[model samples]
Target: MADNKTVRFGLLGCIRFASKFVRTVTQSSNSVIVAISDPSLETAKTFAAANDLSPENVAVYGSYEELLNDANVDAVYLTMPVTQRGKWAVMTAEMKKHVLIEKPPALDATELDKIVEACERNGVQFMDGTIWLHHQRTVKIKETLFDSGLLGDVRHMYTTMTTPVPEQVLERLTKEAMGLAGAIGELGWYPIGAALWAMSYQMPISVRAMPSSVSTNSVGTILSCSASLQFGSTTTAIVHCSFLSQLSTDLAISGSKGSVQMNDYVIPYKEDTAWFEYTSGAKFVDMHTGWNVMPERVTFDCGGTEESQEAMMLREFTRLVEGIKRGDLEADHRWPEISRKTQLVVDALKKSVDIGCEVVHL
Candidate 1:
């Protein structure tokens, strides 16, 4: 619960995602996007105007430092690139403001540790913007599968996420922006978080990655990854991620009695679809017999004029801001822990790629 009084927010960058976050805050009850800073003044003004925000209500700056120095801001959201996230987290923590950074908080555990320590020392709440952790469907899925144990003893879990790369952004996507680790950073972390939350924080015993390049410069167009995670009592799970082809996402869990499949697991913007199949000796039966067994397709009906990714991210940013102001950060566990474990797997995957797809220990 956020305080009735609004928490003022200053966005560090008016990047594509930041704009969406601003709109989300505007629609929220307990927060306001009071200011924003980017390296481009014209771009900032245009964004403000497009969002129905008065120019006076928004502050445009040519640098991020100015936004950090603003006294009206109670919190800051950093949607910057993964390579630059740690620096901004440290700086924001030092400013005495609550911080919610975009996923893959840092490239590795050591960098994430430094950012976490800085926030702790500064007495500020820190969160990674892994919104699925806050989603109602995810909560229900975990409850039905793990808490109720209705699916029988858990046996295996696997996930895959992939998307086609646009020609204009191919170079940045391959080498600089997120790199292979960073691409997996966003899409991979969600399922990892889901596994950690449902499995009670069990760490994977070993990881192996098979990376293939469709082009030169080691910018592998596709990464076929397999990580074997050993939970207690012989329960094992394998996680997979790739950027090899068209946009497709799926997660399947196998159990003794039945299996549950969550299709389109990573992106909520896509239809939220799932199905359950019960094993009957040699074959399986759809539990919802004769009916559409798929989980109800959920359309992302966001209440905003803008239809960009930034708009979607900003709406959640507002909720997080309100949550911090009211000290309601306990709604989700496994944020910090999942973030750490996700990075560990990603680092291991990178090493596996470097060493010719060898199996690496967790």
Candidate 2:
């Protein structure tokens, strides 16, 4: 980086949702699309054209290694499959380029430790692409969580992200050759990350996955699943994610003082404002004849000029990249720590399910 210049973003893997981040990086003032890499140059070119990148400014490569080796590339936004992310992340780290990866990047804690180690050794930044946590709503929500006079001592949280997979995606996911981790690693990761984030990355003492019903494809990939997390005392969280259900994404947090409830936690339905409600006190009126529910609904722009979570996420990531280049000391550890904790809980949930309702200790 030239200190006064935009951070160069080299996008790796031309996945379906790659366009979202591409658009975000282009919109952000701190970042630019310097290069793109995929298995085919045509595919990369198609992506670049869709995102409206200029051929003279953006380089397209058919190989990820070539993109990583490009001198102009400063950081990489990786949108690869869950299983392949670890390999590419380590490679990116060894190459000394900062990494911003999609969620569930680690298959287990062992792999996550290795990825974290590589980045630390190379003095590069590492962050997972969890969208909602970067939103302005999250900032306000964290403030409310600490105000005991408001939401008080958070106790429990429940979140869900269930949406029907497209026909092409369903076929690719269920194929034996792909051998993907199934819906748990795909749609499940967002809500699970939300649950972990609600408690400030506090590791649960134990985890149990208790899905009432399980559906698998013809090739044996799980289509849907759910789990619960125990925080050892009064705190707990539950999450449900699926690939075989209608579109739905929501989260509710309960506390000693009140509760927080909202929909569209994974992605905002609109770009302008978000909706969430909280309640402080409630009671029955006239001998239980009627109920008085004190619910306060909130709607705000959340300071998002780009509107969507992905855009906000990219802006924040780019800011950190530039800040670090300018010698900021407090930027790197925060993202990697959150990413590691999220992956640790996801690994525990999968282990609990595999062992027949056994409680996996974290």
Candidate 3:
């Protein structure tokens, strides 16, 4: 039986994203959001009230240190800005608190290594909060496409995830906020994860990317990219990602015998059904609803499962903490490998964009 002890969680930074996560933890059976800290007291109180957490149970700290010092917090969820995530992760690790940090855990590999070492030394579990990896859809896609051998030997993979930049997000795209590596950092990781997962983490043989100079910011608005990845004996893949225009969140893979396609790759909710196509000749045949194979399609009508990304992330974090307390290290080992490989591909893509040629040995 799973241990029934509640993992007391304190959320750092009452940012807009934390609200949904607070609600998820409140509803989770294995964990609770016992404390919250933000620079603004009013914001913290408002979040607590909206989430139905008692104001007394919610400690509004003026600074993160105040929250870190609290004895009641067994672990922490770090959802601050990408630039500050490494610092917070290191701090939390030094304090001996398990941490689930937001994506791009660090701006560079050096910072990621430091954060990893800190967590190791402190004897705490550390994970990058890449929510999609935790979702069941990823596993199902892998099994059906790779394990089932339904598609024969995989050859090509393409994914598109695009949406208009929110006004708030546009405002923060300045170099001062996210540096010159804009869209690649903010949006490229999703496709990177998908491609890597599909290839079963086989390092790509070569990668190339080109950013269209359409936006005013140094971070290009439109990115046209192609990666040549080799997996096993005869499997080769061409993968693409862009932040340029509106295309359905689509992922299509072609093999020697047949091809499989999935629409709505990034956010596949219960209400949203993904379209699948298999190529026979010049025509494509639509497969039955892909929901049965995609476990994330399993929905809850009540307080548990919802459409909030933040909620899904928090629930997964709670599961990780529970595993940690029980000395289960399997999940912990996989995180660093996946994170490092994802960053490596991102780096290769940037190099390809800069040199106007394919980057090899990524």
Candidate 4:
């Protein structure tokens, strides 16, 4: 890592999802993937070839340890399974390399804490792969709905992120090797993060999973579930996540003066522009045929012309890593804090589900 130089990255897994990062990192201006590793050397080589990665530029390794040992590898992007990532992330940090992990960062918050602690102790940066948060649309939403007080005192939030998964895909998702074999761990992270973001990253007082809403596979891997989070006496967030629903990503936030609504909060339908609906001070007309005000459609152009949300995330993480390398800045604690808060809520909700949908105090 050097000032005004590209931050080299080692991708630690050759899974299908890792391909996305391969493209994003290449599209990013500040980062580049220099190495790739998987359990099988042949698989790593094949993945690199499929991605059209030049051998002279990208090293292929059969073991993660070998890639981590490469001095040119400034950081690591963990695309491994949820259960296997924590130790590897800790190892990455221990070797004084920054780590970017895919979400849900771990099976539970306790596990996430260990990874974060390692980064803190080793003076490395740690960020979970929550791409939507890095989108320009998210920045606009924060300004209009939160900072501008357009939504007033927020009282309620509803979010759902789901997609129909085929049987083969569902089997892969629910495999015991994946650790958390459920829609909650796979798709729920978005809504959970969205709810926390709407509440300014505040922790909920309690979480209760709706028992009736929980559906599981033959292996007892959760396929779909819903949960309620009590933020305060007056504020609550309802989240529903599923692998058995029609494709949808919805978020709605209501406050004292207004409400914010969007159908695609996790990933916008279009890459160039994303929009939301906002409404306030509504009343029925004298004839009671319609409301006094209609919801306003607010749209924002995706700010990064060549950068998607995932690209922006890689750029931002690399920027931080560069700053640390330059000694002009310390690791930004905010990213890890956000990750920890989201993990805590997730753990609480999972606990609630395990305890017969009983409310779990945070």
Candidate 5:
């Protein structure tokens, strides 16, 4: 399966987010953009042209089903809204194509179950568009957390992501939330993922959303939210995500002896490099004065200077897809397993919100 071949990719929607992926697939060594399907023919065609997809290999369709039947596509990227993605993922798998979907892969456990079961039954690899998971910078951090003596016990982690949403957007989301912040599944996905990643994808024992911490509309649409997650008795996590605040996303991890901090964890400030600070073994000086430890800044240069986080994801996806195509491997479950863990926590967070911030038993 590790032969030299390009993994043909089909874009399911021309969502603005898909443009980054278009570039990544075209630039990747083992991937190529071969088809696009969306409701609007012009939207799909324009996107294809802007990306400079070859006309001979790249086809455009006004309907997703037509693209799925093209026979040229080996994999499809689903970029629909979270509530609608589950049905499409199942359809993609049933059509015998590998599926890469946007984050929060499904709205809840029931939908996630359908996606996982379909992918497994159809023998198609499944992954979410959580680009950070595939970033080289995140790779370095994982090493420091697991292998390095820094941040010894992983006792606590805090992750926050917030970006102010316009009135129009808020109006749409308010209607969508129904009663509570139905949009929690969307904006909260990143912080939830960061928390889960910091905890090594272990499901927390329970979750308690911050009571009275959400900003809602008259009908109770969640504009902002915060939650507390408990893992056993020692490990805990805090997550805050909102659509009513200024753009600020951060992560900090602390243990018994030391800590780590980053200003941008969901998406790096730089495309080619990521920055963070870590400290270990802090103690007062012999004179019982200032602390003895000093924080050291570190940066990791991802190999591809032009490769965005999305590019890294496509490169990884294509490599595995290439192997599967060459019969070198079956569907790799590693990515889907991680995705499932993230979704499990996401569902729990929603439950917490649903029950008025009560502790949701996992």
Candidate 6:
């Protein structure tokens, strides 16, 4: 068992994002980095050195298996490329170590299922590193908007995340067939996740690819795409993701009596303060002039000694791991359930695009 106050984490792979977690795990109150590993010994050594991780405290391993075998590690933070994450995640879970994986957890729902099953069978916690969901701002929204019924009945949601990538990078992604490297898998995950959250994690009944908006490369890799998710007869969500657009991470939700709009939902524009606009009880003037209420900016402060979303995520996962270790609680199933729901939608959207933009009923 790990320390009662802190969970020891092993870095499973030295991907680019691993650097952030190196700092985050150190900063978190309930977690500490105990090991680091990569396929190349030199790379692992270099990453540890670059991140200022001390060899005296943090063991460096030339191979992932060695890190997994480390008896001191109670959990693992897997930062491998998305395509390789599932297999390693399963391996980590099989070793009875809690696993916190990066976003887009698997190539598809099928693979994600295997990873989650492994975690469940081994009684290890499983969580995806989706930063925004861990933010206090998100919690505030859930309380004030949805839980309080300030937004009323959710009628529709619109989310988009797009950014322009270089031509060569897009070409390389297409050639290599990186799992979900296409706009849909890479960027669409954000919008789809937002939509599901707005809907209280309800599965959409159907998904339809907007063929008119779909863009593909020479090798038929999706460079950009738009899809519609039908939640019910009266509710729908429109999502657009792209690799060839101005940077945007917009989330808008309309309800019977109010609406919420977020321009930087994925990554807050500022680290210290994140804001969203909310308009409630809106109505037109007698003369059909400008409406009565305008969007009110709701700001969430994340400053002071408060942890970043990344660190909070680690702390939360570690708390769960600790509870399980003490036998006071079972591993939290909610995180893996959320990831599975997100992956299912991603699979449906990809299927719709592949089958000539047909409507896929879930």
Q: Tens-digit lDDT track for model 2 on 1-362?
A: 34445889898898768887887777776778889999888899888888887889899999999999998888998887667778899999898888998887766667878988998998888888878888777767777655445878778888998999876676567534223447766777788788777777778899888856456676667677878888868888888888888998989988887888888877777777887788876567778986677678777785555756777777777777777677774347988888778778777777776677688998
Candidate 6: tens digits of C-alpha lDDT, residues 1-362: 25577888899889767898888877777778889999998999999899998899999999999999998999998887778888899999999999999888888999999999999999999999888998888888999999999999899899999999888877666524556437777789899999999999999999999989888887877889999999989999999999989999999999998999988998888777888889999999789989998789887777732556776677788789989988988999999999999989989999999899999999
Q: What are the TM-scores, per candidate, against the unseen true structure? A: 0.80, 0.92, 0.80, 0.95, 0.93, 0.96
The digit string of per-residue lDDT tens for model 4 on 237-280 reads 99999989999899999999889899988878887778888898
Report the lDDT tens digits of candidate 1 across residue range 1-362.
22446777877767776665666677655678777777787776776777777767766666778889987777888887777888888999899887778888887788888888787787676778776555545556667656666657777777666666565655556535665564556556665665565566777677666444212225652234445556665676666554555776667777764566666555554323323333312242476344333333323433333432344344455455556557775323334566777777767766766677777887
Q: Rank the candidates by TM-score, best first.
A: 6, 4, 5, 2, 3, 1
Task: Point out the higher-scoring one by TM-score: 2 or 6.
Answer: 6
Give the per-residue lDDT of model 3 (tens digit) for 34-153. Answer: 788877878777767777778666666767898999977878988877778788889998998888777777775667788888887887777787776655555555676567776676
Tell me the TM-score of model 5. 0.93
lDDT of all predictions? 0.64, 0.79, 0.66, 0.86, 0.80, 0.88
| Candidate 5 local lDDT, 103-199, one digit each (tens) | 7788776788899889889888899888887877687778975557567878988888888889777767754433243546666778788878877
Clashing pairs in 2: none
> What overall lDDT, based on C-alpha atoms, would model 3 receive against the true structure?
0.66
Q: How far is 192's C-alpha from truth in model 3 (Å)?
A: 0.6
Model 6 spans > 4 angstroms off: 175-177
Distance (Å) between predicted and true CA of 209, model 3? 0.8
Residue ranges of candidate 5 with Cα displaced over 4 Å:
1-4, 174-183, 218-220, 286-289, 303-307
lDDT at position 4, candidate 5: 49
- lDDT assessment of candidate 5: 0.80
Which residue pairs of candidate 4 clash?
Answer: none
Winner of 1 and 5 under lDDT: 5
Candidate with the greatest lDDT versus the true structure? 6
Off by over 4 Å in 3: 1-4, 166-172, 211-244, 269-316, 326-331, 356-360
Q: Give the residue spans of candidate 2 off by over 4 A.
A: 1-3, 166-171, 174-180, 302-304
Best by TM-score: 6
